[model samples]
Target: MLIVFGLMIAGGALLGGEGDSADNKSDTSAATKSGSSSDSKLKDNYHVGSVANHKGYKFKVNKVTYYDGSDFDKPKKGNRYVICNVTIKNDTDKKQSYNPMDFQLNANGNSTNMMEILTKENYSQNTLDSGDLDPGASVTGNLIGQANKNANLKLEYQPSVWNDETVKVSLY
Candidate 1:
């Protein structure tokens, strides 16, 4: 009876190890409700001009431009306007919604929401707006935000409003 009990325990331990290994493997591809583990580890950081995929949309930051606020539309006391020229492509089978509010500028560990600076003549015509995009279509526009005057910035894209998953794009 003692030998039989030992074998049973050993068998249970082996099975438990297998289950743990399977869970670790799934961690690399599984989408967690809080946040994606593989996504945060691998696909989170992107450089300018590099494409990042989230959900079914492909996003790329073509360029980043900083501007001093005009007299009429000045940034908050210690902030400057950041304009990101980005292109988002819908790669899914159905239509997707794109909005400027989905993008956030991070600087000095603070997240800055996108601002609509339509008063800027240069960006007024090319400003990014909220709309639904059809599959196979792409939209390019400038997403504006306010950041610290001398802070390093990272642009973060939140693909879904319901989920907290975000992809970070390095602006500099």
Candidate 2:
């Protein structure tokens, strides 16, 4: 009886040890697979908009239309600031909320002096509201600034949540 009990205990330990190693190997492989696929997925879905490198951030450009400021019922001028209409899309499958204050404007790869006009805080005072964006839904906004000669503007938006990803937009 003693011999049988000892043999059973030894066999149980060997089987248990082998099972743990197998589990570890499976976990490592799963992690590796997930990491590799993540990059490819990012590149595939990156087609929602165009990207332009600006000050280390990727600015996603949606539309570039010259606005005489009359669209907002403001005075129209011959040499008024060009309002770059942009639609920032959430490429991730998760919901994203955007605060316009998180964005900065740039023209010809240089930061513009129109930071206040581009931020949400300047647009609305006393309202700390962040516009909710559904997965794959885009939030539309405008960057008001003087148009440089042959300007190529880049609009930068950085969401507080999720890994920091820049959407680049180039306007000619």
Position 44, candidate 1: lDDT = 50
lDDT tens readout by residue for model 2, 74-172: 422434455555555666666667675665556667765333232334332322235776766665665555545455565555556525655444445
Where does model 1 exceed 4 Å of error? Answer: 1-42, 161-163
lDDT agreement with native, every candidate: 0.83, 0.53
Model 1: clashing residue pairs? none
Indicate the residue-level lDDT of 42 in model 2: 24
- For model 1, the local distance difference test gives 0.83
Model 1 TM-score (2 dp): 0.71
User: What's the number of clashes in each of the models?
Assistant: 0, 10
What lDDT score is found at residue 139 in candidate 1?
97
lDDT per residue as tens, model 1, 1-172: 9999999999999999999999987885564643643452337589999987755578899999888788788888998888899999998888888888888899978997876575978877788888988989999999888887889899988877225668798888
